[model samples]
Target: MTATPAIEGWFTTGDQPALIGERCTTCATSYFPPTAAAAGFCRNPRCEGTEFEQVELSRRGTVWSYTDTRYQPPPPYSAPEPFAPFGLAAVELPEGIVVLGQVAAGYGPDDLRVGMHVELVVEPEHTGEALIWRWKPLAEGSAA
Candidate 1:
């Protein structure tokens, strides 16, 4: 797909795509790609008995780490011939969870930083079957 397709009922505003996740009721921990059921346990031992509740994630976060994929990824990830490198970043959300995703098209290491703020976005993969989550640098004057 030339543009990302929304996963129905996942994001708050379908047009502004986001990753799906869940929050633990007991310890307030969050998970990416939401757990399969509501009765999931928290990773933290003190809150192991908590149940996860589906929730929309914050659109903004600070970069926690980053890396690049210089070679073609195995099946499942589609890349055109002469495969160019793609960036990956781990972002720390407001609720204290870190989410990893690819960087949005046109962004490179020069435009990223460990503590820099970024906003979550979705981009359609070249294969046209799924929407991939990505991150973009937050606008200079925008609040994180």
Candidate 2:
């Protein structure tokens, strides 16, 4: 069976993967997991526009904050067997939003720091029914 996103429409899966967000045509505000239906209205109190466009978000961002998961998460979350700790990061993209995601395998809290540059990557989940976005720390010498 082919893998898919656990929840559809959150991101793109291909040679160049990106988180999909919506940009308000009127006020230029953006939203992730994009607003739909009547919720599609501009979030900005000043703008009344109801039009929004899909946009591919930046693949790189700085680590705004992060943490380690030492224990198995509750139901609906597919935790790895034996439950090794994993890192989670809240990265601030150039678009001015902070998106949270799991850090790439082989990484943990010890390997991360505030403001560290990171890039997006896609990996299969434990169950294999989904492919998920992960964040990888960029090389120290590389500029984001």
Candidate 3:
């Protein structure tokens, strides 16, 4: 079966992947997990912007905070039997926004720390039939 993005248009896939966001045409504010609309007004309280453009966010970011998911999520989520806990993180990308997502497989809270660099990666969801974005911690001494 072909792997497909569980949530289409939220991100790109390949060697270098990035989250797709919307940039306000007038104020230039960026939003991740982008809006469902093709175009709309900006949300900035001080900016009266009325248009937005699609933009790809930085592939790398710093871990602002993180935690473990102790309980299995409820439906329509299909949790595995004897549910396995996973790490979730709120990463702050270079664009000055915080985006939350799951940590890459084989990694957990023990593998993360505040201010550590991470790269965007795509992985199959529980069913292994769809893809989703996850954060992978950058190795120490390696370029982010």
Candidate 4:
């Protein structure tokens, strides 16, 4: 079975995966999930820019916080039977925005700490039916 993104238009699946976001043309602020305002404008209150440019957010970031999900999430999320705990992290990127995602396979909340560097990775989800983005902790002394 071919792997496909769990959610489209969020992140790229490639040799180097990155989150897709939008940069306001006027204030130079960026937004994840590429915010689409009904009025079609920048989200910044100080900037009235109506145009935006697509940007790929930093591939690597430092963990701002983390947690272990011990309970199966409610639907539309399809957790596996006999749900297992998984690590999740909020990573702060160079863009000054925080992105949340699951921790990469083989690593758990025990492996995470605030300020730990991590990289974005696209991998098969718990159900193995779709692809999703996860945070892979950087090995010690690995160049950022």
lDDT of 1 by residue, 1-144 (tens): 244344554544346656667877777777776753444567766676456788888899999999988789998656878798888999998978898888998997778888888998777665657666789988776666
In candidate 2, what are the lDDT values of residues 1-144, reduced to their tens digit?
999986688898988889999888888877776764259577778889899888999989999999998789999777878887889999999988899999987888889999889998888877788999999999997655
Q: Give lDDT for model 4.
A: 0.89
- Candidate 3 per-residue lDDT over residues 53-102, each given as its tens digit: 88999999999999999998999988778899999999998888999999
Per-model tally of clashing residue pairs: 1, 0, 0, 0
Better of 1 and 3 by TM-score: 3
Residue 8's lDDT in candidate 3: 93
**What lDDT score belongs to each candidate, Candidate 1 first?**
0.76, 0.86, 0.89, 0.89
Displacement of the residue 53 alpha carbon in candidate 2, Å: 0.1
Runs in model 2 deviating more than 4 A are 36-38
User: In model 2, which range of ten residues has the least summed lDDT?
Assistant: 32-41
- Please provide, for model 4 over 1-144, each residue's C-alpha lDDT reduced to its tens digit, 9 standing for 90 to 100: 888998898889989998999998889988887874434998788988988888899999999999999898999888878889999999999898899999999999999999989999999997787899999999876544
Question: Pairs clashing in candidate 1?
Answer: 1-128
User: How big is the positional error of residue 22 in model 4, measured in Å on the Cα after superposition?
Assistant: 0.5
Off by over 4 Å in 4: 37-39
Cα error, residue 21 of model 3, in Å, equals 0.3
- Per-candidate TM equals 0.82, 0.92, 0.94, 0.94
